[model samples]
Target: MFLILIKLAWRNILRNKRRTIIASIAISIGLAALIFGDAFMIGMMENLIKTATDSFIGDAQIHQQEFRDTREVSMTIQELDEVGANLAKEANVQYFTRRTFAPGMIASSANRSAINLVGVQPSTEKLLSQIDDAIIGGGFFEKANEHDIVIGSKLAEILEVALGDKVVVTVVQAKSGDYFEDWFRVSGIYYFADAAMNSGMAFVRLKKAQQMLAIGPNVHEIAIKFTSTEYGQDKQVPFWKTYSQHGNEALSWTEILPQLPKVFAMSEYSKYIMGIVLFGVVIFGIINTLFMSLYERMFEFGVLRAVGTRSFGMARIVLFEAGALAVVSILLGAILGFVLTTIFANIGIDYTGNEMMGVTVQEFIYPVLTIEQFTVYPLAVFIFTIVAGLYPAWHVAKMSPVDAMRRSF
Candidate 1:
């Protein structure tokens, strides 16, 4: 009986070629939109994370417990050699670099602006962040000890300085509280999408910055990059615990920027909201198609009822017809979604220099395709299509032979 119903449903849809094609096209569009939308959101979020991390921020950071809270120059990481040894042995750690920081003033001939002075190893810092790539004018530190300095373009305009121009750096010694000042020729100027970084930060070699601050062989911070971002995102991993000893604190980017996870959660809620809106709109179209088919066959249905065809069998055939239509839609939609996503994944969409959620977008975003897009969305469309068939099936089944025949021409 089930096989006979399936055969009848297939034949019934085939009888009206134009109606079947139109219904299938409408449902296919819905499924395709869902699949492509999911991929696009995933890509966007992933790109945001990459931008936030790679723009002078590593996947994770380590510091003395109070350095984060106070930004004090005195809170240097202890037992540096042992910490370096452990990091070298850790498989998940791809790159780590020593850094020192101080609050200081950069004085040009015309103006003086507050600065967050950073010390970094030139080679390792290049591998860890996009600082080298961000140099729009001048150049990055050619050698770690070259007395070269890098400042942002915004800060340059504020101070009225240009490449090779001389400037004075002023900071207090950590132990003596005595003011120390030095002159440096600006060798590089970098530009970042974030306004904060542009106007308030400067970078010099670790050797020179440490000398300026009078903290010999001691670093205030250790920046770390993991082999994969997933490792750094998991805060509970043993690598963090192992190195987070001896007055040091290890933190993933999530802990460092607490609001990022909240933004990610909100993005997920948007996906469900979009899905509901789409399903609600497409459902009406499905019902309209089913009703038109039912009314067109009213005379035939009345004939079937007069011959003692059961109500359950008539309802099952209509539901099967819905499934058939859904199957065709799912196939076409899946193919279309796959092709579009794959193309974008390769060519990418440029959103460079655009800022979002407090981070600058440094590169292009590519749609990220997943197996669930094909499976979950198609399954949802099939189920929703079957549910949509119910009202039309009920309306047809409950009609008496006389009423159905009278309504038909």
Candidate 2:
């Protein structure tokens, strides 16, 4: 019986070729808009997250309890190896390394600037951060290399320093001694996502920093990378709990950068608003098309009823027609949207406006395609399209067979 209904519905839709074409186009437009919008939003979010994590924070960080709470270097963890060993046992842990960050002044022959200097173990640093890949010129620090520094692109520009240029760094040591000073030859220049990070950050070998600052092996924090970022809060929370139990504190990327969640939240809310507006516009277009088709077929409906066809039967035919059109249109739209998004994902849209919040983003925007957006969005659109035809079906069912048949143009 259902198969027969579907067949009848298919034939009836074909009988009015123009009307079917218009309805299908309306549904297709709606579905395509939703799919594209979702893809673009998700893609942008992924890019932003990647940039932030790569430039500074890793997926997670471990720190001394007091250093985290007070931002004091004096309370740094001396037990680095013990902490690294414990973290290595975790299934999701990919790379772990210790780092010390200090505020210092850097000067070259032409320019001088205040910057944040980061001390890192070269091999472990490469495993935990994007610094190695981000180096645009020269080369990363080698374990055997001493008194060598890597500066951000902006910093290099400001300092007018090139690869092998000598620069002086002066920092206040933690031991309450007089200021410590050292000269380093620049070996690399890197460009990160944020202009501020590039302009105000420098990297040096951990041993060099330790010797210059008169500090021992104590490190301010331990940065970690995970096998998969998708594990996110679930993996980090348990690890933090375990570490806290052993007298240390653990923090996730989200905690290290508190502003990220707020940014993502705002973007998500904007997406919802855009989705609602698009959904309404599409629904209105579809409903208008369906209603017009119903009115044009009133005479045929009257003839059917006058010949003993039940009102429920008429409603069923209209609904089946709506469902069939929806399915066909949604499938077509989804295929087109997926193809377009995949193409754009590789090409990306570019923007060259003023920097936002210290980050100078590239001009290109990329769309990200996810299985949920491709499959679920089309299904939602199809269901909405079918529902939009309900009122028209109900109106057709309410007309009296005698009045409908007696009507003349």
Note the residue pairs that clash in candidate 1.
none
**lDDT for every model?**
0.86, 0.78
Candidate achieving the largest lDDT: 1
Q: 79-197, model 1: which lDDT tens digit per residue?
A: 88899888989889999889999999999998999999999988899989888899988888874435688999999999999998989999877888788888888899999878888
Candidate 2, residues 1-409, lDDT tens digits: the string is: 6898899778877878887787777777767777788898777666666655654678888777767667654666656777777887989888888888777999999999999888898888887778888799988985367888999998998999999999999987886856889999999888776666778889999888877666688788888888877655464357777666455778777777667767778877887777667777777776787677777777888988888878888788788878888887887788878888889998986643335433355346689888888678777876777787787778777878877777753
Segments of candidate 1 deviating more than 4 angstroms = 143-145, 407-409
> Model 1 has how many clashing residue pairs?
0
What shift in Å separates residue 312 of candidate 2 from its native position after superposition? 3.4
Once model 1 is optimally superposed onto the true structure by TM-score, how far is the C-alpha of residue 61 displaced, in angstroms? 1.0
> Candidate 2 has what TM-score?
0.89
What's model 2's lDDT at 280?
Answer: 75
Q: Each candidate: RMSD to true structure?
A: 2.1, 2.8
Model 2 ranges off by over 4 Å:
66-70, 235-237, 245-247, 262-269, 349-366
With candidate 1 superimposed using the best TM-score fit, by how many Å does residue 286's alpha carbon deviate from the native? 0.6
